[model samples]
Target: MTVSVLICDDSNIARKQLKKALPEQWKESALLVNNGEEALEALQMGNFDLLFLDLTMPVMDGFQVLAAIKEQGIQVKTIVVSADLQIEARNKVAADGAIDFIRKPVSASALLDVLNTHGLL
Candidate 1:
């Protein structure tokens, strides 16, 4: 299915890999950014349906992104994709407005499951 996706990760490989894990159309249309600042800038342009966010980065972190999205009242689905699997981290993102969380090196099946659960697939 077609979906507008914004992928924020510091690692170039991780960003591209995450894009590839999405549905074909989503993969084709995904936008990649290196940090939360870039992600926020992209989001402010307001054309994306979903955001795949990483927790740690050089400029701003995923938590900051979530907070800014909330503070700004941006309307978009967000899923935190991070290596940090700490319960606190997950709970924090959820509280900050993430719809879901996916571990790093995400499998296509896992990504697909979130999409299906949220009716994004």
Candidate 2:
């Protein structure tokens, strides 16, 4: 099965970096969005296997997105990608149903690690 992924971040550079770091097979199926609001819209329209989300963003943040996903019962698995490395933020995302969290600046290995741990790679 082709695993579709949605990458949501405010920084264009960050989005590009994440997309580039994805496995070659997954890159073809990856979708990029600028923020959580856009991520939600995309989620509503398509079924994505994974979500690479940024914590701080304009319009809507990753925390809000995670809460919305849980409240609305969205099925995609989420891995938060954030510059914030605080324990509180990590715990919040974890509590909100994110499978994993990656601290920024993200590396190819980090992406691979999260994917592998979650059996998405």
Candidate 3:
């Protein structure tokens, strides 16, 4: 089965970097969103196997999006992809039901590791 991924980040550079890091095998199956609002909307409109979300954005933040997803009973898996490396922030996100945490400036190996651990690869 193809694993569909939704990438939500505010930075165009970060999005481009992540997109470049993703394995070519998954390129055709991923969707990119610029903010949490778009991510939530995309999740509502279609099914996704996983979400790579940023913590901060213009319209909505990752925490709010996550809460909304849980409130709405959406079943998609999520991972926080953020520059915030604070333990408290990580803990908060983990408490919110994220599947994993990936620090910003993500590497190809790191992306592969996350996918492998989630059994998406």
- TM-score for each candidate, following the candidate numbering: 0.97, 0.97, 0.95
Candidate 1 weakest ten by summed lDDT: 20-29
Best by lDDT: 2
Per-residue lDDT of candidate 3, residues 5-107 (tens digit)? 8899999999888888887876777899899999999999999988999998999999999999999999999999999999998999888889999989999
Q: Could you give me the TM-score of model 2 versus the true structure? A: 0.97
* Superposition error at 43 for model 2 (Å): 0.4
RMSD of 3: 1.0
Whole-model lDDT for model 2 versus the true structure? 0.93
Clashes of each: 0, 0, 0
The lDDT ranking, best first, is 2, 1, 3
Clashing pairs in 2: none
